[model samples]
Target: MTHTAALALASGLGFGLSLIIAIGAQNAFLLRQGLLREHVLPVVAVCSVSDVILIAAGVGGLGSLLDAAPWLVDVMRIGGAVFLLVYAALAARRALRPSAMAAEEARSGTSLWPVVTTAMALTWLNPHVYLDTLVLLGSVAATHGDDRWWFGAGAMTGSIVWFTALGYGARLLRPVFARPVAWRVLDALIAVVMVAIAATLLHGL
Candidate 1:
């Protein structure tokens, strides 16, 4: 493979690995829904699809535009920081709130559209997603020169594989999350993760 191709492969793997390892809002929501064993497929499908679309858009031709438009990056940075901070506080509030004694399973009866809509909103609303996929990862792809498209494709491929694996894999933990404490613990962890991301974003700003 040419040098650019190799770089693209490595960068794609890096982008995927960076996201897969992070337990952010998206992953936390997925894990919670997964533990509940409700609407797992729809939630995961939405997350994966959203990622693909963003990655494609970022890589298709917007990398240079984003780079040139420094003001846009600044806007995204500030917006992302504010969003994460608010989300972090909300997560903490959810953690502190008392839960019902009964371990109520998430109602999976709703049509799949709710699942899809919620996932899309969560992923798309956060400016951090733009920072991660559109700015950071897209910039990496741009470095690949003519092979940038392949790099974008590879990065998106990773999202598809990951969400599918995580969604299906969560079924294995259904029994453990049957307890109310399990959910509280999971939510608490999620809160911590969100707070950390928020802190990081603020610090960077």
Candidate 2:
């Protein structure tokens, strides 16, 4: 393969690996709703749409500016770490809370608009998201000479496919999550994932 093609492939893989496996607030929320059997399609729809917008923004040279302004990236890193930590704490609290109350809160009608808004915020507000998709992924793509667009395309494709599978796939596990204990376990797992990611981010600083 040519240099540009190689870069495109590597960049696409890196972007996919970074994002595809990480279970974030979006995934947790989707899983929760899937378990409850509520608004699954709409929830996934909003999430996938938000991700496409953010991923496109990242690949379109927005992430490149951060390289010149290292401090800005640092600020984002810190801010994202703090946000993740706060989310982790909240998840932990929910895990410890009584199941009946938690179920009620989860079942309560949450406006689809708010969920979309929240998904957008989660995908876009974090500096790390831009850094990962725009800066890091874009930088790699730039190395590929002219075919960099393909790299971005592949990466974006990965994001769309992954989220769609995750949001919808959660439904397949409905039978398993029927137990109250299963919900607690899922909440605890989400908290752990968030805290672990936050710790990794902080350690880099």
Per-candidate RMSD vs. true structure? 3.6, 3.5
Residue 31 lDDT, candidate 2, scale 0-100: 71
Residues 55-155, model 1: lDDT tens digits: 98888766677668777766666665566566566555555664421322233344666656657756875667777787778777888888887787778
lDDT of 2 by residue, 85-200 (tens): 77677667777886654765655655566555555555655665676667666677676657777677767667667767777677789888778677778778888987877777
Candidate 2, residue 149: CA error in Å? 1.6
Give the clash count for model 2.
0
Model 2, CA-based lDDT: 0.69
Location of the lowest summed lDDT over 10 successive residues in candidate 2: 100-109
- Worst lDDT run of 10 residues, candidate 1, spans 99-108
